[model samples]
Target: MGKLKGEYIILQNEQFYLKGYKDFANERLKIEDYRGNIEHIFSTIRKLQKEDYVHKTIVKCRTKSVPSFLGQGYMLEGCIPGYFLGGDAYFLCKYHDQKRFTSSMWVEEDKQLEEVWKKDGDIENKGVITPSIRKATTLDAKKLATFYASVFPIYPVPIDNPDYVKDQMEENTIFYCIETDGQIIAAASAEINMAYRNAEITDCATLSSHRKGGYMYDIIQSLENELVSKGIFCSYSIARALSFGMNAVLHKSGYSYQGRLKNNCYIYDKIEDMNVWSKDLSALSAGKSALSAGN
Candidate 1:
């Protein structure tokens, strides 16, 4: 087995990620012969259990391997369409502790919140000055970390570390922040997949004092516009299932509800399900192609 900074445990063929900060384990099976390696995969899961790193196990595999994972007591959580170059990806999970599996309260909360937002009408920015929305530079890493730490106890990425946040920003990840009086009050990111022409909008956070002002919605809209201008065709987010405000943001922003991934991530000291929301931006391009063909 190989190890990467003790964060990921890489086997000969598969890899198990020990999300130490989150206290959960996730696996990625890279081999094509998933059917043949069922026993090996289970054994690796058992190893994860013995190491006391098993609050839950999330398995991300291609659509074709769903059956193999299902045979091993893994339940189908959800599917992310066009996640893999026009092919869909499926998420399966096996919860070691039954207590970790609970009904998703966000589903109902989302419906109620949607109705409320509809009745209340658009969020007013009157009298309240809007923050400047712009791309974050590496110099803003420390501020970003501070904002994230204040919002979430545990996150998938090392948001507590300014260096890690800076590195990701230097890489393909683009961070957008809402700045007021030289302070970042809210932030979000787009993980661009240039090969697939899609992007994952994630890491949305806002200071407690700055909540309910539609800053996140503005950030999402700005990010989506930037992505579309860059030739990206799809944008999606895996928002916390229990967050009424976040779900409402996606719903009001024209993103369609796709599905839910159960026990997908650890946040606020517990394993939480995630709701998938996506928007397709390829309609204009498809229409142009059809017109060109007719001409």
Candidate 2:
């Protein structure tokens, strides 16, 4: 266990913390990864947000900085995540190759959801909607978590436990839903790394009943529109190579393929390739409805 340093003022404890690093290889940082301490982090951030600290930018690193366990994490509030604060959130890994660093190298790219624009105002209904689109309340966490576990093979720290989903929902990291007929279904949410001014769209799913009904598309489009109106035009998301449908959605919405992290993701039956895609609202071709579709 090491330490972290920065000009962080913990509002709840009435204390100030200096930036440093913490080592977890020999021990578990918290109940989970260091992120479990988010309650403490949010205490100060919540106050900062109230005071408009969104403009402040701070660089931080894992213990040992370079050649460390979790690598380094930086925080710059105003700029877009991932690109601007490219090294903000990452995990370090030791490559067996002789040329690799002795300890390890940090590898993480901040990805965020950038809201694009409203399509001629919201339509009361999207085509063949099965699960109704609604804002997820705290109560829906259990179903939401289960939906994500079913759709994609990502096992959270708690896997399919509803309590874990509830925890995530409480942290604004989850949204939930079900079919219009009341059958449990779709879930979506933003996994925000506030330290990097970036957020990733995670746990997005639509159950079989809601499939092909355009519910997921509509919900994502709405979120994008909201972000675009707020001036957040760039975001990054990773999709499994086999998830052609997900990739197709990003393409239709105007996301470009920046690059890929070879064989770096775990999907249901195998280790999957992570496809990195970026959406640039600054240059949406006029009258272009489906950029990825035509290409």
The Cα local distance difference test for each model comes to 0.70, 0.44
Candidate 2, 4-101: lDDT as tens digits = 11132322233434332222221111111133244465344334334321322222323323233222232111212244335323322322223211
Clashing pairs in model 1? none
Error of 2 at 217 (Å): 1.3
Model 2 stretches with alpha carbons more than 4 Å out: 1-82, 85-94, 97-131, 153-159, 172-178, 226-232, 281-295
Candidate 1 clashes: the total is: 0
Ten contiguous residues with the weakest lDDT in model 2: 24-33
Q: What is the lDDT of candidate 1?
A: 0.70
